[model samples]
Target: MKLRYWLAALPFIGIYSGGTLAASTTFLFGLPFLLVWNLIWMAATAAILAIIYCLDTRDEAAHAGAGKGVEK
Candidate 1:
């Protein structure tokens, strides 16, 4: 949905591409890049998840406060 999402995907895409390349080329350096790429991707994913969690919590709190002022 956002550019951040697309940017976040790049590391994972690199990992997959690197892995495929490694299998065929069998290069030592390629393996390290793959591992690093995956690790970076995982970190990015964690950050995104944390942001989503915070946003949800904020929304819930806002709704609760708003509800207190309304009467049916």
Candidate 2:
């Protein structure tokens, strides 16, 4: 697999490991620790996805630019 694939998996790995770690902790601000942990991970996942999209878009644009003067 490519490096991008591994990079894409990072968020999931973080969520799983972080969640497991957070679950054993106490609550904060009267809210469940797990809830807060999951919410943070969700935001992180969104950011990661956005980064992946931007990278893919950039790659596509570069590829298109490179092919502009090519035949077939």
Candidate 3:
């Protein structure tokens, strides 16, 4: 994994810690705090994974193009 992938995963670390460290006396829009927080983080993780996929695919295309002239 690259540094960018590791950095992208930082939010997950924060989400896990936040769920454990925070008090349970709060609510968001009638939902429990952790429930809302977990849902938001899940969406964020999905978005980050999508971005990583895009980056990986772009890099693959670039490498394929660069290798085309040498393969003959």
lDDT of 3 by residue, 1-72 (tens): 785678587776958876674585688899888888888888888877777777666677899799878956
Model 1 global lDDT (CA atoms, 0 to 1)? 0.63
Once fitted onto the true fold, the runs of candidate 2 whose alpha carbons sit more than 4 angstroms away are 1-3, 57-72
lDDT (10s digit) by residue, model 2, range 1-72: 866577699877876776667757888778887777778878988888887776676677888899889998
lDDT by residue (1-72, candidate 1, tens digit) is 865566567655655665665444433445565566567667866786676555456577888899898889
TM-score of 3: 0.64
Q: Give TM per candidate.
A: 0.42, 0.64, 0.64
Native-to-model Cα distance after best TM-score fit, residue 59 in candidate 3, in Å: 6.6
Model 2 per-residue lDDT at 35? 78
List candidate 1 segments past 4 Å from native: 1-31, 57-72
Candidates sorted by lDDT, descending order? 2, 3, 1
What TM-score does structure 1 among the candidates reach? 0.42
Candidate 2 weakest lDDT stretch, 10 residues: 14-23
